[model samples]
Target: MSQTATILVIDDEPQIRKFLRISLSSQGYKVLEAATAGEGLSQAALNKPDLVVLDLGLPDMDGQQALAELREWSQVPVLVLSVRAGEADKVLALDGGANDYVTKPFGIQEFLARLRALLRQAPAGEAAPALVQVGQLRIDLALRRVSLGDAEVALTRKEYAVLAQLARHPGRVITQQQLLKDVWGPSHVDDSHYLRIVVAHLRQKLADEPAAPRYIVTEAGVGYRLMG
Candidate 1:
């Protein structure tokens, strides 16, 4: 018996909320609406939704501040939607604990795909499988071993962390701040150089070319995604 997932949509725009409600309910999702950050935060605490679709523009409170406060108490996956499409805005949201970011005027298909990707993450504390495969690459999550075909590829802990996270979400983009914060902790979210170096090392070990990368692909100013 699969119940529809509940989604908390926190956006101040009435038209946007109605659009999202209709769009989400069409797919059998239970939609909860909030017109302000305060109300949204309150609803999230009371409802404990399966996922949150948050807008960065709110009337009562700064959306970023709300996100940071929510992060302090909740680990629910947040997909940030905002009209601010700047690289810095994306970086700040991701570092502030958003799972992903989508700029406004987005295509519905892409938005739903990203939403599905966010919801697919395994819940915390469940044992991750020891063996996982993506294409020709095999990762032993328990042993922390990675191999291509029959040859083992040596990787540092940080390199393996990056690879494993991407593997967990195959073909989906993992924001740089999310990766950095997960692997190196919260303080290093802004240290883009460190993440780039690790990814470079992982690519080298995997024999992937940045020009036409087969394994790891950069998302220009956004972040990185694993290629299928």
Candidate 2:
């Protein structure tokens, strides 16, 4: 089913577009291409592609603007492609509605892996399950509630967002910058301490032993993963 997913690749660079078109098409995906943001949006609306590959630098419109505009009308997942590798740029793209960001000169293998993960976590058309049981913790995404065994757990907005993000991916190691951007917005991307604090709070709430958490495992300087 993943191989059959359609993707729209939007970039001003003909070479990049050609490369991705061939690469993705060879993998069994129906690839659509557009040279500008306007065309991309038009194609998206018309085709309703399963995923979008958007370039940040567009001649007619900024990539962030396009993401925001598309998000206003559709919840289709968007993956940003940009020359800018700055944490700030990544944060802005993610905060503006991009599901993921990849800098230029990216390895094809890494890019493909990221694409797969993003698609795997794409929201389903039908309603999601109200109760999500992962390991020893139970989460009610609809009600924004959590429980550990028989005890009700309390979590802050940020903590819940972090936990939910991890829950969405299960074993995936979500980067610190990505979590920061997704949970705290673009402005707080540089503040790694914020993630630490929130993660600690979440562990305290969900883990029997905060120091040796079973569900929320830290990946040192990398990120956090939810071990199911």
Tell me, by lDDT, which candidate is best.
Answer: 1
Task: Point out where model 1 deviates above 4 Å.
Answer: 1-3, 122-228
Which is the leading candidate under TM-score? 2
User: Model 2 segments beyond 4 Å from truth?
Assistant: 126-228
Q: Compose the digit string of candidate 2's lDDT tens values, residues 1-228.
A: 378999999999999999998989888889999999888987886777889999999999999988876774567889999999999999998888899999998888898888888889888783223356877688755345688887888887778888877876677899999999988899988999999988877776765455677788888889998876
Over the full model, what C-alpha lDDT does candidate 2 score relative to the true structure?
0.83
**TM-score result, candidate 2:** 0.55
Report the C-alpha displacement of residue 217, candidate 1, in angstroms: 49
lDDT of 1 by residue, 1-228 (tens): 123888999999999999999999998999999999878877886777878889988998888988976764467889999999999999999999999999999999999988888888726542333356766788765345799989999888788889888876667899999999998999999999999999989888888899998889999988999875
TM-score of every model versus the real structure: 0.55, 0.55
lDDT for each of the candidates? Answer: 0.84, 0.83
